[model samples]
Target: MAELLDNDDPRFAFAALKEYAANSGALLRSHIEAFGFSGLETVELDVNAAKGLGTLLASKRYAGLVLDRYYAHAAAKWLAAHPTLGRLTERAARSGAVDLLLREGDGTLTGDDLAQEILEDVLRTHAPNLTCRTALILVDPPASDAAAAQRERARSLRASLRALGIETALRVVDANRPGISLPEAPAAEPDLLLNASVFGTDAVFSDEPLFCERCEAAIPSENVEPKSAGGQRLPEPRLLVETAARPLRSHLLIEARRRGIPAVSGFELEVARARAVIEAFLGRPLRNCVSATIERDIRLEAENIVLIGMPGCGKTTIGKILAQRLMRRFVDVDELVAQHVGKFKARIYREEGEAFFREKETEAIRTLALKTGLIISTGGGSCLRPVNRALLGLNGRFIWLKRPLAKLATRDRPIAIARGVAALYEERAPIYSSLADRTIEVSSIDETVRAILGEHA
Candidate 1:
């Protein structure tokens, strides 16, 4: 981090890394394993290491380093405990003390300034207009220390809100309880339900956690059938703020939006730390650009351009073009599957079976789903699985490339060959339609690309 701060150029820092490659290689591998990439061989270090390092060092703005979650959380606790210091920093921010903090790098100013910055963003529109007029912060910690820490964090937030003349109450609840209901309701529903708990972070297992998409009812994950999906009921408030970092459209947020509620993800609030750091470094306040940079980062980190359609519908072709135009990494799921199996898609189907091919496809999708900022082209039938659909939809914007069934080339496409092109199209078209966030009719490649770009813009 210091190296990057000194140079302010990713290329220069990366070159320094290569100079100390032996030491950096072991250090990088340890961090990589910590992020869940295990069993990495030393021989494949060049390719895998470069990819991992590039992912972190590609942007010199260094938002992730500046907006460190640990620092922000620590700052919140500090502000909660030190009311005098908090007031001083609040006055400092109001008086443009950017120069003091920038020149001194004082820890005292940094923490309070960061906490105040986050508060400013959150209260931009002021508090909610509910009868209760008090926000409820729900916390469920896994340990005693965690409980204490969460209490401090909540207290910090309460202190910040009090400064703005808003009232907040923190409640420690049991997460395993079947239903989330308050012991005694206020005059009306709480102004906001601040989910500082870890309940919704397990969204992948439950699919949703507020309301079912199809039935519009609260159904727990265990009670639903194997293939059926539903969500559990959460205490509703005028607004929901989840404090854990999640994808832009995690099932928790999706369910909230489906139920006509406004939700704020953790990613939105994390900008405060980065905003504070950048402003300190620049020696001036940024009126704009921080949010804009965050929005762009969202596009890069969580919103992928995913193309899906029948085989030979130009998904791969259009995906390549889109990848180049957008300057994103391109991934063809079919190619990834083939690489995993050491065989082509056609050969796999002919030798092993569709079931085996499908397994490999799911594996590829699962791996790719965990990443972001890619133009992904999926196989014709790969997305038919419910799991695959969920995985892709987690971090991607699906664009169905619609070409005439007759126009689709079927060369070496085993499924397209086995089932006639018309039959395959008829079977898969509805799924494509269901999953598509945007659909582009494949009249002209350039026109289709333009439509996708325009929609994104």
Candidate 2:
């Protein structure tokens, strides 16, 4: 099995994960079976760490090479000489998979070229059975030369798709343009949207901005305001492919999921490429599905759990319990508002009024939405505004905790007290149902926790 990489060493993160099934618990009472895997280990590394990659490759034990688009061409010359890969290339030629060989250029083949090659290979190999007829390539134009290069790349991609019997269209947009409106789709909406844009990839990872700062100036998602052309909403593509590896950091990915569009992360493509190379080196297929497992693991570790419902529906209580059990930080939007106001929620309602309290709530939610891996409990009325809903829903799985109105504790909750429990429930029930990703009845607290865990598991 290929080993998982540590981020500290540039070569550490190149593992092709294999799933193995094993029986547990010897002849015990009611022999229970279970699944297990190693934990993810994330370490930070810089561009200089690429030196370690060369040193590691010299060891010869690591035959497979999978690199980021930016670094692919940098090591292409050395990679072309791999004895195992050379043998595999001969086999691939005999089998008529001509593109299997690593193509070289006169030091002109760039990271973009390698990325395009990988994209083509992935389409030809894995999604060969796809029935999608239309594709749109959205480019983020930099300089005039870069823009032209991107256009040429898109044209090449279009030709590749055409060879696969899929008609494709190209759409280039200025990612920097304010209030950018994407061009309307043709008679039929595009089946796939290939975001070759820098929207997600340009942002600086604050903790590790040494590399990012050398590229483009960082743009926060809050600054990007993309709207559909005209007054109507842009048609959602069936599949969205972000060329950026870190989809979680992208606003585009968040918006895509919220609109029910299926997305493919650029990292998935990298993993697929790595898996293929590793399988070739091993001379046998690995017993694992790359995309689904990686996607699930990333989501399970990074996504936030949000509890939203009536004022006294046990969101806070259950959220605390869930957070403790799952080992995630617990955040209460109500407490955030109170912390900002320097008073209790009811005091804020009485002294500063509801508008002031809501403003604080929105500010808090906006900040928290940018973070990940938290268990959040919202103020009963916090998600009433669409912006709040968007902020929280961007990275959270909202769960509605439903309980009998009479059973709810309404002592300190001014809103629930002023507005009768029945009346408030009648007003907010529909919104809760609409916004919740999962709805769990508040039976016993333990049962409710189990239900939430089961949903996530």
Candidate 3:
């Protein structure tokens, strides 16, 4: 066995254990016992040894391999408590390769009917190609007449699935009975496993399979918008499996890791979280992808219509008309600054200084850039600040509303009155032209609106 092992070094003793287990068809406990250690103390195993054991167990060679009763229970508990293991279980369940729901409970399945309905709907919409095969595994079956009632409900669930063209099966197990055990993975594995029973029972410990809780009738919750797959309306792919016991959640996660499945903590499994798991499982993007696509469509209709150039270029008048025609929100950057400072723009510049006004103007532009579908009228010097220019450039389609120097507004405007329109134009014309997505020479307010609307259309 030593010579047959993959690694020759004694430091890799688990390599030898792997070779022995592969060839001899012995359980993991036997190998651990051979090494003079109780398999119950699995935590004592080094990280490499633990990983090696998990790898060996997951391999096809060791398929259907069973652990000793004590070791099996211990390993199941350990695996259930693992943190990162849940991700793999989630991945496998959402891959669209399998459509299974495993419900483990006593004879009475409280929410089985609702789960069946949801599963049927999911199959009809998103997974039309796949069969919805469900397994109702009854753990700790009740005594006598109650047992008969449980069987009836199971039959009803089976019938429901059948109506939807889903194959269904019912397995009754009495874990309390001496020597009897729960079914192992691969043989009895389902795509979605619902642990309706309390944790640490025979059902949860029996197989290292992914576990889910009862389905919420209104899952995907109110906040989540339904998405479309294959041109069919589908509820967001989310499994709302509730488990109150933290240890049980951990145990299921551990089983997922051992079996190379993705699992998420039931408490953390929201619509968004479930979508993320599905994305990981399918190896494609979902909600974010859909959002990006929608945003692209909106940009076509509502690209930021930014009006730029000299102070009296009729930007505010044209902006109002364009926004009304385009059905977008109208925003004047100078007005935003006035609102922010609780004073008029001229007052702010006179009392607080030109620098103070520019700071407020820049803040308004930065804040407004986060939104879309707007016609923005900016102050003459708003483009002078590179920060403001960058922020506006990100979301707005800059439109230079150019005007003759004499036509520029000089009355009541301090910059135009002080610097003169010719000086302001010399300084700002190049920046405005460089930044403009479209340059429209100002003729009349109606003409400007028509030109913008034509270009936008």
Candidate 1: regions farther than 4 A off: 1-67, 72-110, 113-120, 123-126, 129-131, 134-140, 143-152, 158-191, 202-232, 280-302, 454-457
lDDT of 3: 0.47
| Local accuracy of candidate 1 as per-residue lDDT tens digits, 35-110 | 2223333321122233433333232322122212222343333334554433235533342221112112222223
Q: Largest lDDT belongs to which candidate?
A: 1
TM-score winner, 2 or 3: 2
Q: Tens-digit lDDT track for model 2 on 1-457?
A: 1243112233222311111011000100001000121121212223442555345334443223333232332233333444433322322222222212222222211111334556766555546334566777776554663454345445556666676666776654554543334464442566676776654333222111111111232222332233323211233566667664433435456556655657666645544444453333334655667435643655665578889999998999999999999989999999998888799888999999988887788888877875668999999998776657656765677889999888999989999999899999999999899888889989999999998898456
lDDT of 1: 0.58
Question: What's the TM for model 1?
Answer: 0.65
- RMSD in angstroms between candidate 2 and the native structure over all alpha carbons: 10.6
lDDT of 3 by residue, 53-110 (tens): 4553333331012221112222333334442321112321222111111112321101
Candidates 2 and 3, the one with greater lDDT: 2
Q: Output the lDDT of residue 428, model 2.
A: 93
Q: Which should have the higher lDDT, number 1 or number 2?
A: 1
Error of 2 at 45 (Å): 7.2
> Lowest summed-lDDT stretch of 10 residues in model 3?
229-238
Give residue 29's error in model 3 in angstroms.
Answer: 53
